[model samples]
Target: MTGKTTFEIFLATVPGLEAVLCDEVRHKGFRSPSVVPGGVTIRGGWPEVWRANLWVRGTSRVLARIDSFHVTHLAQLDHRARQVAWADILRPEVPFRVEATCATSRIYHAGAAAERITRAIHETIGAPHADNDDGVLVRARFDQNVCTLSVDTSGDLLHRRGHKEAVNRAPIRETMASLFLRQCGYSGQEPVVDPLCGSGTFILEAAEIAARLNPGRSRHFAFEKLATFDAEAWERMRTVKSERIPSVRFYGSDRDEGAVAMSEANAARAGITDFVTFARATISELQPPEGPVGLVIANPPYGTRIGDKKSLIPLYRALGQTLLARFSGWRVGIVTTESGLAHATGLPFLPPPAPVPHGGLRVTLFQTAPLP
Candidate 1:
């Protein structure tokens, strides 16, 4: 039987930002969150699982490590799967799906392993299995003959904050955007600005954070479907509220009016419109808001998605000029795939972090400490 107060939990993240997610998890009070490949692992009960989904902005999803055992072959896998106490976690009336993967193991066929587990579940717990994409997912991975099982507790990726109803091509995922902000040393205390704010994701995130609003406040999680989930406790957990008088506001400007409008609508949906401003203007038109200088960050086009590198150099140059000329005291963070393009900005950035995979390209965030 699983302990009533604790369970194994993994916070999923992209490969490059494992340390970033780990920092966020530790800051959020998770017990002994350790960095692991493709994610972070923490041992906690259902409330900790729910809180991670709701409050930790850097994770892509939250996974509960439900069960595991050793199995050399399909028959052993089937026998062990049948003995697992599925009724302790899953409801017989609710449907689920299994996805199995095997590597360097005797049971090498993923489909056969999945079928065996599904049949066992049907016979043991009476919960019908559905297609993988549509229902609660039970993931089985057999690595080196050890079968491990987990359930995806966050259904839609946590990046889908459920508030951004509109976006343009190549919009950054909200989770990545939040991690980028944290990497930039933004604590939501100082003003933030995004010159190429495609859908105002950065601005909205900054505002909500400054106001002490939870990132998952407006959404639901897949854990709600599990038998261990307590609806009454979850309701109370989500209702825990905090309000802050933000220390400063956020600002964004984009050359495309359509992007500006989209950012505005997204901010309204997130209930952070009052703390942020979006205007249709070119990068050359960007000016610091009325406050102490803060961080100026942008996810400018990197030629792979929008245009030629030669064509974007002048745009980057103009951005560099604007910051150097008018915003002397502020810091800067730029995301781009091309080192040449980043050099084009002419800002004295520290060494770049390891490249992060985004939109099919390996991109890095080039950041500067406060400018002289």
Candidate 2:
């Protein structure tokens, strides 16, 4: 595969958030973005793949769809997998790994499919293979005897962002945080406040967006090690910075002093300490910052993850009362697993999106117009 060879690139997202991620991809100017079952698909070449890894905030992984074919059994899978030009993508010196999943197919054994593909790579490209932990990942999905192979250009999950080293209990992932912000109509024009901030994922993501910092700037990607990678061009793409000082600041507060400290430290690592503020305060004590009536969003503790429902009801109630009373003209977004907890806020929420899985719980973002 050459740098200019156009092909299908998939942006994988949480199942329920596919449309939101599709909007982001379209906004970023990727060509022919279409929502698929588990993610969004767009057509692009190698540079677009790099940009997707470097720029997209809502996607968990960026996959280069290299090849696809019909296969009924393991023998056909092995033959077609070996027929792929693996040497064009995988460097012989680099280690690689294959992952396969089968659904409603004659080749129902994922392990056997993976083994055949692994052997194909070894025989064709001469690259060493590793287990779950290491290697450049090659993914195969078999559905109804049709198999599509993709290269996972993202080595680590995009949420890692290579900055946050500390987190509180049941903390939200950065990828989800960013998508939630976009769903809340945040475009970096207004300040963001997170009263229940745990390690400040939402606030940090907001600050970076406002400052126009690239989400993947501090991280490395699997694409950098591919045979098609051009070091000079990658550096040029990576170093092209247009960051600005944000006009408004982001704020986060938590009752736990340790959580507050972690948020502060995380902001520093993300290089947005100058644009974000952290404080220790209870839900009752939470108040909007002085300058702007912007967005107040939070991922508070729901009964399933932290405290019991009985104990958290009052906390939710206090959060709702505070926002309703003091945050007039400011929008609000609260994410929680329990409908009762969301209702407890009493923040005049509009209809919510479908619940998306997060940390083993299905959480929904309950949003509101400017609070009444």
How close is every model to the real structure, measured as TM-score?
A: 0.97, 0.97
Per-residue alpha-carbon lDDT of candidate 1 for residues 94-190, written as tens digits (9 for 90 to 100): 8899999899999999999999999998899899887557678888999999998988999999999989999988989999998899889888889
Q: Cα miss at 342, model 2 (Å)?
A: 1.0
Per-candidate RMSD vs. true structure?
Answer: 1.4, 1.5
Candidate 2 off by > 4 Å: 1-4, 305-307
Clashes of each: 1, 0
Best by lDDT: 2
The global Cα lDDT (0 to 1) of model 1 is 0.89
Total clashes for model 1 = 1
- lDDT for 284 in candidate 2 is 86
Model 2 C-alpha lDDT per residue in residues 106-129, reported as the tens digit of each score: 999999999999999999978988
Model 2 clashing residue pairs (backbone): none
Write down the lDDT of every candidate, Cα atoms only. 0.89, 0.92
State the displacement of the C-alpha of residue 301, model 2, in Å, after optimal TM-score superposition. Answer: 0.3
